[model samples]
Target chain A: MMPVEAFLRQDAEAVRPAPALVKRGWRKLLFGDVASSLLTVLISLCALWAVPRVLDWAVFDAVWRGNGQACFDAGACWAFLGAKWPLILFGIYPPDQQWRPIVVVLAFLAITLWSLPERNWTRATATGWLVVIVSSLLLMGGDTLGLQPVPTGDWGGLPITILLTVLSLTIGFPFGILLALGRRSEDRMMRWLSVGFIEIVRGLPLLTMLFIAAILLPLMLPDGVTFDNLSRALVALTFYSAAYLAEVIRGGLQSLPKGQEEAARALGLGRLATLRFIILPQAIHAVIPPLTNTVVVVVKNTSLVLVVGLFDLLSAGRSALTDPDWPSPYIETYILVGFVYFVICFGISRYSLWLEHKLSAGVQR
Target chain B: MARPSPARESTASASTGWRIAQVAIVLSLVGLFAWLASNTAQNLHSRGIMVGFDFLWRGARFPIAESLLPYDPTDSFGWAFVVGLGNTLYITLLVIVLSTALGVVVGVARRSSHPFASGLSAVFVDTCRNMPIVVQLLFWYAVVAFGLPDTDHASHPLPGVWFTDRGLYFPRLHLDGPLLPGVFVLVVGLGWAWTVRRRDQRRRTETGRSPHAGRKIVAGTLVAAVLVAATTGLRPSLEYATLGRFNYMGGVTLTPEFVAILVGLTVYSTAFAAEIIRGGLDAVPRGQWEAARAIGLSEHQTLRLIVLPQAMRLIIPPMTSQYINIMKNSTLALVVGYPELNFITATTINQTGQALEGVGILMAIFLAISLGASWLMNLYNQKLGLVTR
Candidate 1:
């Protein structure tokens, strides 16, 4: 037998060669094979070429403060953003009432965050969302609340985008579920009708749908009945969102074993009761992640309203660039708008992943 | 045969009440559509707008600014629609090819064991995908329109390639002499070469021997085509761009709008396509790779002959959806003022006051394309999928 000290020393030597292991890992990552070695060099060279140029443009040589004239040879015209951010965000809302849109934006954020936790996702949260949305719209449509009335035309920029996305989704969710159910229903007529509606809408691009809303809806409506561009666009988005979301929900519904419905029926629940209590809850939860992805898509697609002459966030940015006083800081303005879109969409996507993890723990797909 | 989803039919026959409810729902839906149709008629009649295809025959007085086909301002609206359609298809095809290539690269890189490759691809996908494509299109448009140097200070990025804010100009190729006869001969030669390739593959699979005449045939076909072109005086000539009075002339120009839309769509679509491809690749069992290597196959051979075929089945379904998305998203070209189908439709509606007809036509054409493409893809999917039990 080896001495106790000798054995202990051997064990210690073998336990954790942390630095050596890490060194080998780095070597493999960089130069494990000829292809990897070459790729490592190529990546480094590309980074060397691009990173500093980007850094200089975005930071080092950027103008932090000044008007258009100081931006003549600047790498980035950040000051242009400072001067134009109000217009970019409020889009011709009364200068004094700009805080209203800000509140609307905050209300949207508060409801969204409050409803994020799994335990918090109850009917009360949905009611909270409804209250928030109604209050926000009333705040904006201020004729009744003794505040200055802001016309829908003046309802431009980020609030429009956020509101459109949230409204379409909320209105479309139940309709989407109904469509999904109809498509899978035992009634042949119901199934085919649902299929036809979904396919027709899904077949058309959002741009074409917007064209219908903006141009054709007036012609299609009664002579005296007219809806503004915002209402028309909301209608189009709701229809489009319902179709897209239905397909995603259908996927979740299909994942369930038939025994679920059969078991619910065996438990003596009625059809509607089974769907509401047993089927829909599980099915909707199963697809919440994908539903959020579709929501992100809608958030992006709201920018298409710009094509319809609606003053969405993208349109606001474009209108801001029309100021001749500014030294045509087109790139800088676009970067700011794109960054805002990125933040909204990326936040939703991250939350989706987190929810997926939370909801799917120990559950095999 | 396609797999029918287990729809979980209602366990018992519906009660009379349920049947009545469904019938009522259907009838109400029909009545609603009928009401809308009559409402539309009344509105159109009151507005005194002509609602028919008759406007299509009239000259489209507006300028299209850009078209793939030769077009005049005096062209009929019907012809204008055709031109717009040609432009849409051209961009759609070009973007599809480019995005597939780029998406595949980024996707493969995402799975790379090399840390830099995977990390870089991850950043690229995240950034490009998170930003909306419309913003990306407008951003790219700005970059193309204002970021590039003007013609007077154009950048020569490569030989025969000029980049300017006005457009990108490249040396144009002109084939002299009878192009039809030379092209006919080349087509025949290529067809023969394709047959040879098929035979080679057939023989290889059957007898474990590839009598590789396919390559020789391909080479011979190409040489013969070149020789024919030379003999027929159909030699290709390059026309270099020269600085004209105001801008560069005499070479092909890709306008700022076209370039912006193309680049934007390709980059945005690539991110989604890359994610789909990555998922498909990840779905392929690791055991397959190890087994291929255990049988002494090289890494390249294992990928080409073993891994990709398995991964392809998983990839194609989602890829079809991605391709369809690309086609639909191509309409975002409207944002950059590219004269695509939606752009033409809007313009036609504006000029003719035929919004209903124009939108109807647009939706119908899009519907046909979407349905037709999905049908073809489903057929192809069945071929690649498991055989019927």
Candidate 2:
């Protein structure tokens, strides 16, 4: 019943729909109007040749169980992981009390996940983090609530790694903020002290710091006031991370406009009040991405605890390989450990990227 | 605008109070240092641990497996440290060059029109950057380096390059003739080429015409250098490795530890450098590229002449940080027993029981290196920075 002109218009519209995105992309990637297409094809061929071999070695031909003899085939011996999972996860924590570390790790993971969701900043979150830290310490340290007492030296594996990371960040973050403020203080002495501390700490490698902690720190302490290996490493880590974080916080402070402080002052806020209520909130928000990156670095650096003779996750895996039963399957063990690290780090990075996007979007409005 | 009053008096009191508080803080800090020094002194006295750099003059008596400088067990601790430092610098320089080259290629490939190449590069960067460097180093040492065939059955990848569990052996080139005359000729040729290029540039600017003499000058310089080298007979001959009962000899041998550290640092840093380079490239405006194309410049020419210069300004600062990171990371050679600075310091501390002195030396060396590197990079950055009107 349509008119001839309307019919003609409908036909034109139907005919004018561009090619599907897949088709266009396929042409652009493979048959790209020139030499680039050939390059794409060549790369595709190489990947095609490589991907299956890797998949075969990693999955199809991988041996998931049985003895070393069963894994003689030219593929990954995942069986080593299956057998050594407990040792890798719990280290030297007594087999009977392995559940303690498991609980602590779960609590830590829960806290991290709970903190991931975006919300208006509140004091309750700080309280929650505090509770998490206390509960983890109590659970790992034991002796209360009818739990067996475990010395800090007995702590190892993923629990220790996570604890060191979280504790260092939680304790170091405030100090880092303070140091940043001090570095920027109007008072010359405070500024010089802050600069001296940050530069000395940043100039040295974490290994050297750990060495100082494990070896020299004891000498500096008054007699009979001893620190366990874990405590010493934790102290070193906190100070080291504080120095780096101070730099990051300084960067954040530098980015703020002078108008912010002036506005706060005009509103009759004291210096401390202006910093706490106005400048700090904005500066910390601006630096969330880099701060998250520091968290990732902290987690990765926990592996250095191995050099200090602490059995972190990496050290636990290395120890597991020493078992005569799994002498030659170190590749498999390292890959498994590396995967765990990759997951945590990659997740942090993805979250940071997402946070950057959301923050930038907020700025645009 | 009003006359100063009692409020001014109170303000003066407040300023005086602030100054008093500042002085109190300074005094307290000085007191803390004094306490620490006394405590350290007492602790050392009780433990009978000597604290001085006098140990530097003592014989090391510990053999280093690999050293860039000649070292023996009889060498002094100072000489041992020098060897360690040389090894560190050798690896750091090689990694810087290799990572920079790899980063540029991968970064450009990331922006390639080809999806496959870009995707592969992205995967490489993501996988590498996410994993811990120590674990990667372990993998390189344990799986890649240690997994190589034993020396007796070393794999011959190239005619004179042997790959084995012990290390990689490659032909070392030796200059066979007088090098000074060849170097002089090359310098003269380069200077001549520069003069020609500068004159051509002036002419082009003044006359608004492209003489295009720079290319000819460069070619002429290269030919002249080749002729001079031939006349001087300044040839380089390969010193190939000869297989022995236990190991290869007569060639440059890169110990497995060195190879592992080199590969690990290169691969890890290349990922970060690629990201930096990509950021620099993305910072360049698309209009610039279009303008270059509009001006009849080819794609390669546009990239080489127009795009990279702008990108370099953005890249240099971050690239400098990456270089510092690489230098710091070379300390990880300890894990694989490559005997770099950190390892040497640790050994010195363990053997001498002078933890304070060893740590002090370590910190001082790193501080000097870090500060010197930053100074040089800042100078370079100032040169490359945009010239504002």
Best by TM-score: 1
lDDT of 1 by residue, A1-365 (tens): 77788746544345754564445578877999899999999999998999998999889999999888888877889999999998998787888999999999998888888888888988899899999989989999999899999889889899999989989998998899999998998778878989998999998889888888888778777777889889999999999999999999999899988999999998999988999998898898899999999998999999999978888898988898888877888899888988999899899999999989977884765
True contacts kept of 2: 0.58
Give the best candidate by lDDT. Answer: 1
Q: Could you give candidate 2's per-residue lDDT for residues B183-257 as a string of tens digits?
A: 777787778778888998998889988776767777777787777877888887899999887788888998888
Docking class of 1: medium
Give the clashing residue pairs of candidate 1, or none.
none
| Tens digit of per-residue lDDT, candidate 2, span A180-274 | 99999876668898998998788777877887788877877778889889998999999989998999999999999999998998899987899
What lDDT would each prediction earn against the true structure?
Answer: 0.89, 0.86
TM-score of chain A of each: 0.91, 0.88
- Considering just the first chain, candidate 1 attains a TM-score of 0.91
